[model samples]
Target: MIPPSSCGVLVVGSGNAGFSAAISAAQSGAGSVLLIDKCPESWTGGNSYFTAGAYRIAHDGLASILPLVSNVSSEQAERIDLEPYTEADFARDMRTVCGGRSDPELSRVLVEDSGDAVRWLARNGVRFWLSFNRQAYEVDGRTKFWGGLCLRTPDGGKSLIADLQASAAQHGVTTSFSTALVDLRYQGSDGVVATVRCDDGRRHEITARAVILAAGGFEASPSLRSQYLGPGWDMAYVRGTPYNTGDVLELAVRSLGAQTFGNWSSCHSVAWDASASTDPNAGDREASNEYTKSGYPLGLMLNAEGQRFVDEGVDLRNYTYAKFGRAILSQPGHLAFQVWDSQTSGMLRAEEYRPERAEHITGRTIEELAKACADKGLLDAEAFVRTVHEYNEAVYAHRRENPSARFDPSMKDGLSTQSSGKRLSLAKSNWALPLDQGPFLAVKVTCGVTFTFGGLRVDPQTAQLLSPGGGKIPRVYCCGEMLGGLFYGNYPGGSGLTSGTVFGRRAGRAAAAAAAAVEEEGDLVRS
Candidate 1:
């Protein structure tokens, strides 16, 4: 709890970014740091707890990356063929994924500081392990880890949140859960103070020298989703916290004159199980990120009309999954089914097989699978079978032309169907395999929005929220999903957590410095 009088620094939200700011501020010599969040302490980590805990960082090779993991067996280590992910590769991927519209300044900090930032997290007691199940494929007795995403915090987001909370407590930063920010009271001579809505439904005035708003975006508000993200967005299921109704973003913009940047229509959404719950307080950790159907690249997506609507293999799933949600939402009925044969069923993440959470069906043949999907009102039985047959013929034709080519899931191995008149409007550019294997599976999916891309703009150097006139908000800094401009049309996998840590560190240090400056100048005395 914050002292009734005042504090040196105040950090709002207890997610990775908020905790990062609080810990950093305390380390920077802030006398009193208070961390506040609207969620109860038991469920207070924000959407950070819903993450898979993947952190994308630039590393030379396995030798440089292996140390970050808390544990690794010699057998598992020796079988891994990990490649280098350089800073250039990270930058290129970020730009290419977002079509070059990513904020240059913010993206630079994310890419350049990602390595050290993750290391810093580990040093502060967050444990990580190679995301073996998500990032690796066992090929020829060797486990090959592809994509820039390799490390994940132990037990995924749950562990990451727990550890960060423990670390914050150890650093002498007081935390108050179920405390919502009512408003910011700015006194010209004394700087900014905040009015908070405490757990007991009473409002309290809290004074602080500096405040950092790491609160998240407006993904939870249906009306805001429709107004800002455009038509059909209100129906989208929220993948994380429901408390992130954009109150902080609105406060910073309308009340504090913060500049809003990034594409309002763009967001970090994913292909989520259609039956997933919409409640943020839904205590089902399995229903969190596990509901995501991210293995589309290894399979095909069929719309309600039994037609392919996207080039599922246009790129690695990491680069393409975020945008696929919008595509699914655009499909008829805002639904789609990801279909895969037995050849690749084992290839999907373990989450897909979770009986309690996944909406999956199995059939002995394509014909049977199509019928089963039809029974569930997911597709037209005949049309789906016809589509499968045509796709198979194309796959066979392509294989005959290049007999030596093979299907490799770890990378795009030119496993494509032949260009023919029967080709659907959208085609799978890579990893296109015939659904001839028995016991084929299909999982119904819809869009699950993770976070909004639009938020209060901030200076990359100091992490201070920027005004519309291009000036800092002085003592107020911003981080996490609240700090927009890094992402726009699309997102690179694992970059969210990396960004939270990077900007969180900068914002924490800056807020602490601002507090020290006020005290040193004797302009406004600290209580």
Candidate 2:
């Protein structure tokens, strides 16, 4: 437990950005750097612990064989690409996705140093996926391992979070969890923080030299959501734990005259929650058409009104799938059922939970499975049968009338969730499970936000926090989503891991340099 009067480079939140900031601040040479979060060490701090850890680096080291997507003269890709993609094309695609607000320098740093950043993790005693021993960025689809990080081995951010925590301990960085930040005290016009208040109904008045607001977004604050996102709207907070409360943002504004942005905006997330494994055919309903056409495509989605609003079968980024994720929260019971057809192709198989073993699957007579699910207490079976029939009529009518609709030709890709070779195509067939299938299945799903997207804003080059009037907040630095624009809100697939690593290092080295300077001057010297 940290004493009420403790001081140093104070860091808030224990998620990815917070961890990154704390470690970076400590290395920056700040004396007595402290890590504090709203939750105890026992529970997960926030969504970062459950992320996929996919960092997008445009080209996975293929600059040579292929011209850099930008200038033909560039070298092969990252030299480690297990999958095929060009850096230039990836950059173009991301810029296009960002609709132009992404900071160029930040993006450049992320794309350029992402590999080195992951390698740094390897240097920090973090576990590698290769312990079982196949290999890495040298391969294509994977990179630095998270070990038994936060969750199990497969997911990425969990390990990154775990690594940060362990590294903090090894470095002698002090941490106190389950403590809430209630206010921030600015020392002078330079915008330096002098102290912080806590929610233990007490205040922590210390002579802190710097502070990093790694406190996560307000996705969990129902009041904030109602005030900012929408009245009926709530975050997918239930998708994971609820440590994020916009505590820093709210506290900063309410107390220290801190300026904040992105409070009114909420990023896109996934809208399906597969509770109740009782539906024997549950696995099939999760892959969207993009997954069906590609491999591991996500399943179909429907709104509360039982109407398919999105393509229903496309892969990630077809349209900010995150926006549709909000659709999950808007549904009745904040849940909707993802249904699937009995496609004999083993291609749609999900290793997470195998559906191939269901002998009860029927290829026709759609409502039979609905009755079964209702009997199993998963849905109002009769209503489910009706919903399926309506979906079939819509599909048949659309195909007959507009067979040549907007779908891209490659949507028919015979393989991969990220498209086959070049562009990651979007597929809508995830919506095409004909009601004729007899043993159809449904799984309830809710909004699944990968992680909170908002936090502090930082200067591009220095990675330092900025004040409301729009100037750098001296002595205060932030990186990762804790800063801004790198993720650029909707996420470009793979940027999270990339941003965390890049920003983490920048903050670390900067913090280290700062600490060294402070010690030399005796300004932050020991009492």
Candidate 3:
């Protein structure tokens, strides 16, 4: 006789992924599924709680699923350029990311099931902004393209997690909040996840047939952040609360000896240091622009030897990609600068982008900006001035081309359009003034990123969690940023939500099936 001590399914997390798994397993007749979140009820991390909650699904491909949403505001959405990278193209990119180590079957599953994920959300009362840029994603089939809607649950919620939490309740899933899962225990079968322990020094024994870990990444854990992402970088989570501690990921890898991918990560460049010191309404994407040595865009980066590297005027994302992820007090260079002009000053003033108490480098001349830096103990004023003088001269002499001598037109535009300190074009400074404008501005900036591009390897089709041995980990699943090694390290917006839906569906289906199969064999609760 099976003891009453065991749950049919134990889900370790309360974020979107964990909630989805619990709800799916419960719906699939798991009898009972318990969700354990290490965080307090209001503060589950993993990017879901404070996420804009806008998901993207195919635009015209699945017109049938279009009518399911109850309410969506196309106007309220961030309508980005959806440049299409086709199914094949996406597969190729993913394959490269995984270094050709992914299962093709899983990839296909993710592509196919992703559509249904949107529909499932609709059926659960989630909504999406209907009017989308459908033609945008089809342009090149390799560029960042997506023609989809911005999704949210009804009544203007703050994030997708709230909607999911409420839905889990509606579906009768049990919740254990503020409970951290410290370890994973398996029964006789290594394939089966048997139990999870809470960090409260209490052992909540799990007699479940399956366990789903939706715990988040290492963004919030300072130690983990330094260990995985590199040191000396302050995590600027300007938005979401700090609660996720990577407990589940630790449980999976360190405890279970599982495999992981996507060791490389990026900070989204601007996003690493840009958030609400001021209202974003006025700051927008322009607030994080790079600065000239005269303070045009202020990212002045140096290497370990204190040698100046990268021109901040270059694409910020490039630095995030190539730089960052270094040791504390010992990165290639722990410092960078952001410089700007009068127009940038106006932008910051319009929104008070800089914190009211922060010291700023404002000058009618580069000498003054350097002096301001010295006043703040940032660097020697003389050396700083000379460095900028030399840099600008090089930029003026075609050492810095209109489009980076190394970057494509789209990449240049993509980067330039996003940064504010950098001129829209090096040639035009209001077509009237230049970085030489009196009262130039500069701000010492920090370079750090939140998550890496590497994560668990999976089969997207079945949403099957794979073992390091290249075999499926039975009764296991992954979604969200935990999806690693796909795309090799590059990311596209909306892809996270896309994977969540796609693999979430597969995980839900598979978990339910696992429960049912065990019941048929008289190994689990038949209910």
* Global CA lDDT computed for model 1: 0.86
Task: Quote each prediction's TM-score.
Answer: 0.96, 0.71, 0.68
Q: Write the per-residue lDDT of candidate 1 for residues 317-422, one digit (tens) a residue.
A: 8988989999999998899988999888878888755667687788998888888888776657788887778778888877777788887878888878755434
Ranking by TM-score: 1, 2, 3
The 10-residue segment of model 2 with minimum total lDDT is 144-153
Off by over 4 Å in 2: 3-8, 58-81, 84-86, 128-157, 187-201, 235-237, 254-258, 274-299, 317-321, 331-333, 344-364, 372-438, 449-454, 486-489, 515-527
Candidate 2 per-residue lDDT, tens place, 139-231, comes to: 133232211111112334566567778988777778877666665666542233434445455556544556666665666666665676665
Question: How much RMSD separates candidate 3 from the native structure?
Answer: 8.2
Query: What is candidate 2's local distance difference test score?
Result: 0.51
**Model 3 residue 296 lDDT?**
25
User: In model 2, how large is the Cα lDDT of residue 430?
Assistant: 36
Which one wins on lDDT? Answer: 1
Point out the higher-scoring one by lDDT: 1 or 2: 1
Better of 1 and 3 by TM-score: 1
